[model samples]
Target chain A: MREGTGLPAVDLGTTEMLEPGTALLIPTETSGYQEDIGLFRAETGSYYALDDECPHEVASLSEGWIEGEEIECPLHSSRFCLPDGRVLCLPAVRDARTHRIEVREDRVLLYPGTAATRT
Target chain B: MSIESILVIGGGLAGFTVAQNLRARGYAGALSIIDPAGIPYDRPPLSKAYLLGQKDTAGIALAPAEWYAEHRVELIRGTVRKLDTEYLGVELADGRRVHADRLVLATGGSPRPLPIPGGDLETVLALRNKEDADVLREKTTPGMRLVIVGAGLIGAEVASSARTLGAEVTLIDPVDPPLVPAVGQALARRLHAMHLDAGITLVHGTPVDISKTTHGHSLILDDGRSIDCDEVLVGIGIVPNTALAQAAGLETENGMLVDENQRTSNPLIYAVGDMARTRNPDGSLERRGEHWEYAMNTGATAAAAILEQELPVHGASWFWSDRHGTHVEGVGDMNGVGATVLRLAGEDPIAAFHLAEDGRMLGAASIDGGLTIRAARRIIDRGIIVPPESLADPGIALKKLAR
Candidate 1:
């Protein structure tokens, strides 16, 4: 049993649906947040969650390409550091809001509204 | 030569980027940006979000007011009267002479005025900056009849935004379906078709004249057909602000001619963004790029060159436009010689990919397919050859092919 942070942890289902180096879009209803959450699994097997919307324009970050620990927004190519949601490029100066994510025993757990701090 | 102080003219994205990158690259020199508009704000949103009242002036600002103060960048509010190349500075229109060790010109461009009669009327509008957007926004009202001249990016965007604001928009253009060179014919057709669907009257004719009417304005097409509208907006294109560059004797054709490092004929001065046209080593002048990303890229290149640092590698030219609640993105040279492989979703064409004769990807354009365009940009940049079958298949993910 993983220690909970006292916040509501929504089980995003088995990691089978979210393979390594892929991203899964958790809808607003599932995340219980106003905006959708983007759940990304890096090739290194690290899971990170961020707001699905790109800060620049009306773009879904979940549809963006993932390279290493950065997610490049498909629209305008504004890249964000996956771990801390730091903006890595121009056209987008605002940092994206990141959510905490933990994967235990193939079960992906997402803490909605919890800030993902750089470990 | 030690560049102790740097002066940048124009406060658009290009000028702001040069100043921003200078600070980012740890050049703690006396940096100052002079512009008629004090702060640097984004222009792309001026046509869509800003005009539609979705984004405020602050929202479209390149950086907050505190950013300049924090970065020690002095923002000067004034226009440049003359470029003093000998003094390596500028004379402000207000008669203030400011000197710096290095001078950067990012003067950007002004809206291309209509050549017909009544085209230059004060009532006729054009959107290029925040002030222009504000005026357009104020004039746009429900049931207002608006006629936009030019069906290009800005014209089309204003048409879409005006329609959203409950205005009856009539978009007139010389070409039946414009922007074929930007996004290719297939995507251009689809994008132009959206105007009709959005209740905008698309006029396929050239405007010969604009005359004031009793109620509003009347635009006479080449065929003598007239369009009556409450407001007229001209979004044809832009004329580069090269007066300062020309007066200083820096090479200028369509725009200020700059070398690979963004250095003009005079090494002390540099030019970037829409007003700076790159001159190839073989003496061929590249077209001046007016896109937002191109401005930032040129700014970055100028900054690196100024700091004696390695220039940042830029990928294929990319641009995006939002209209009718749909996002369109294009990358690379879509007009190049290639076969277009279109990915369709049922009856709708979602993505179009241009593949070269040698199997390499030349360019791509998509409607509401940002990811597809992003992947195609990577493929084009990396010189990756993708199978046309896989590119056309909607089932196969574009990301997979990029890898």
Candidate 2:
């Protein structure tokens, strides 16, 4: 229901190609990869991308430990999921965002809202 | 019945703030608030400015009766006995039920009682809310012997406030060096000296053996020294009101377990204030914060989360007290910190800063105008490291703590 849910996609030509099991964090509008928290290979061999920066404090999820789909921030250790971006911890009441990615031929491009606005 | 209405229970500081914010933020659905205690009132001033007659109870209320009606906020009067999540409602004590789409548990907490004998019979008093202050105020007579248990922030402040009202006060606690629970033992001792200088008798490393009397009460010490007192005041600590959460099958630790958004086990429910102990980022359970600023900030944070809105990052934890006309404020925990910088603002003010090993502010203590403590609070939250020279120079107002 927020503004700019359906925006035109730009052609992200040739870049480093990641396998279906692995994810790459490319810069998105207003959002960043935050840290190098590689990616999660789902049961269906799908990759989910997320911002390693916690929505709560200055804690980085890349430095923190990961469990299943959830990555905990090392600073405050607030847990956020890579799939739907749901928060599962205290002191962090906001949810981190998951970028919609389009893997064409070999390049990976991140789209802000490939689906609905979860902001 | 399907609930499209939110019922905020307990019209204390937390409850009113939640309702006030929801309306301000454009929540147009049915909003209700519950309070058996009548209009929303403030308890912070009751212990300090109110007792000193600096401010009256009327000045402290968050909401008057008319404000609720103006906002179309349904203010209910009665005790909310049980909460049923499946039914999407709360059951009143009188067998009535209030329907709600969401629930906010803001019951607050009760004061910790003296662990001594005869504590049950009111030989001593514990203060957490406004009612406790009213009872203690009535009993405080001129030149009455008052043996206060616990020399922590509450105990010391109460002692200081009671002393101003003409009571011979003796503060009893087990802190060999006071303020040990907050700042380390060494720093607590330094502040303990301040209490002693204020003419308060500190019975450190010992507790009072309270006994009831025909007239009033008598505290028998371990050394066989009995101090006859008209009354006793306990400032040990507090316990959160978490029974409602536990009864509703919500997870609870020292208080109700809440996520960063202050959400309980159920997503439809949220808890805040003293009764809700949220886990820190380190996976440690942190509860029992009694500061007014912390309460207001945390309460606001929880309210925002419930609306699924982005909350401004939580600032550092803070505790403030006014003792014997002296203002004492602390930011962050100083026990794990080191290298306290002592500075004096002119000849009238004093400031002390506790720095973490990494040079970030761990905590700050100040006297006189409370400007430095306010500034230091912002600095600690942002993890700003002030230069040692800046800290040492009394010319530098702690306003530099705000990054």
Candidate 3:
């Protein structure tokens, strides 16, 4: 898992607020989304969040394109499968660090690190 | 008989892909691989991290030793001296003959040697396998004057790696605007500039002579310019190992000729990777594709054909090269395709999509925009027609146009 700032989980937005094939960029500091975490809404209505930085290069996943259950990095086009964050292509030999995301009512909450357990 | 036993000659990616994909597709046959190298490792990193001392040889193995044993795949470390197609067996250098129901040739290729004066000097080197890379790595020290005699992917990558190590690099090639044939004039110009900006001396000329100098060596170019250096690294190209195939009476041209199914002249024998020249869909012999993806795809194609399984639809040809810390990729047949459209303007992650006359996407190339090339690859494979305006727009998701 990537070394996070160890910040507490934050309430992102509503389930309806993020449509399928949409990704929201969240930064570590509230200065402006320079890309810290990428919260993605898969076409299958599943929500996945991962480190915004691509493991292959320094591309932000928030600026990448959503392809079904995978996210293609805009910079190097490395594909990471959702939920597990396992790399599905070359250039990126390692998997991306996936974060836990849960929907409470219409709000989406994100927990950093490898623990994807529900509280 | 349903291939009860198989013998794969080579431990490279192509050999591994065939063995693994066959097993994944439920091949319960007796499998064995005869590789000159003891372990099956990746070759791409030889010019990058592996050469820079950032990664060790063990880290490059495709799979752990336990994985092969667990999968019941026999790995034999020996060189195949000849292919006995008469009995579908291979003659090993140790006078051992291994017979199999199906035989696959994944012999791969070797670096083409420079045929100039003083080309065989001890300091002159070419990288192909791990052993070659190890020697190159030892020579790449700070202040080492390196003269590279090609601007192709391998040469360029070596130059980048050498430069990163604080070595003085002079890259020379006969072609003007390096990589223009593959990535087009505009992108090649950007790459040429990048090489120059990184303090590498890029010379557009062919080497006519290589002689020993007091410092190390001196390479005289066709344009009469001379470069004095500590070592000469030649990365011109590769020549496929076809002697074994030819000895077995297999058809050979650019490489061991194979049908679309990866079947050689003999129905029981197949060839893949840099050694196999496949027949195109149009019934013409394809110039062998030596990239990693082509090797993997051909391996898979051979496995599916052997298993009598439904062949997966072949996608657009794809390849990636990393130099100067940027990943550059090209997908599909850029040369055989129609006009090209620049998706992103300016520098850095520039992308271009080649479209047929009827507006169908045929291929794509990108600097750091692998995602764009990924999307365009599907468009090419599926014969998707996308409006030029939509493709030019960065906001528009290229994958959405697939449907």
Q: What's chain A's TM-score in each predicted model?
A: 0.89, 0.56, 0.83
lDDT of 2 by residue, B1-403 (tens): 4436888888877777788777766777898888887787767667765665665666556655687788989889999889898997899999999988898888888776656567666546887767778788888777887888888887887888888888788888775776755644444665667767777777854554677788788877767777777888877778788888899899998888887787888988988777877866677886556666556666788767767778957667766566765556666766663777767555432666788778988887665533566567668877777886797687665554453
Candidate 3 chain B has its poorest 10 consecutive residues by lDDT at: B340-349
Cα error, residue A49 of model 1, in Å, equals: 1.6
TM-score of chain B of each: 0.99, 0.90, 0.95
- lDDT values for all models: 0.90, 0.69, 0.83
In candidate 1, what are the lDDT values of residues A28-96, reduced to their tens digit?
A: 888787779999987776899998999888788888888888899877788999999999887787988
Collision count of model 1: 0
List TM-score per model, in order: 0.95, 0.72, 0.89
For B1-403, candidate 3 gives per-residue lDDT tens digits of 6679988999898988889888888999899989988878888889987888877876677777897898989999999898898878988999999999999899999888888888777678999999999888888899999999989899999999999999999999888788876776667778777889899998888898999878789988888988899989999888999999998899999798998889998999999899899877787876789888888889989999989888867788888888998888888866655787776653443877777888887777878764677778878887877899888777776657764
Model 1 achieves a DockQ score of 0.65
What RMSD does model 2 have? 15.6
Best of the two (2, 3) by lDDT: 3
Q: Sorted on DockQ, highest at the top, how do the candidates line up?
A: 1, 3, 2
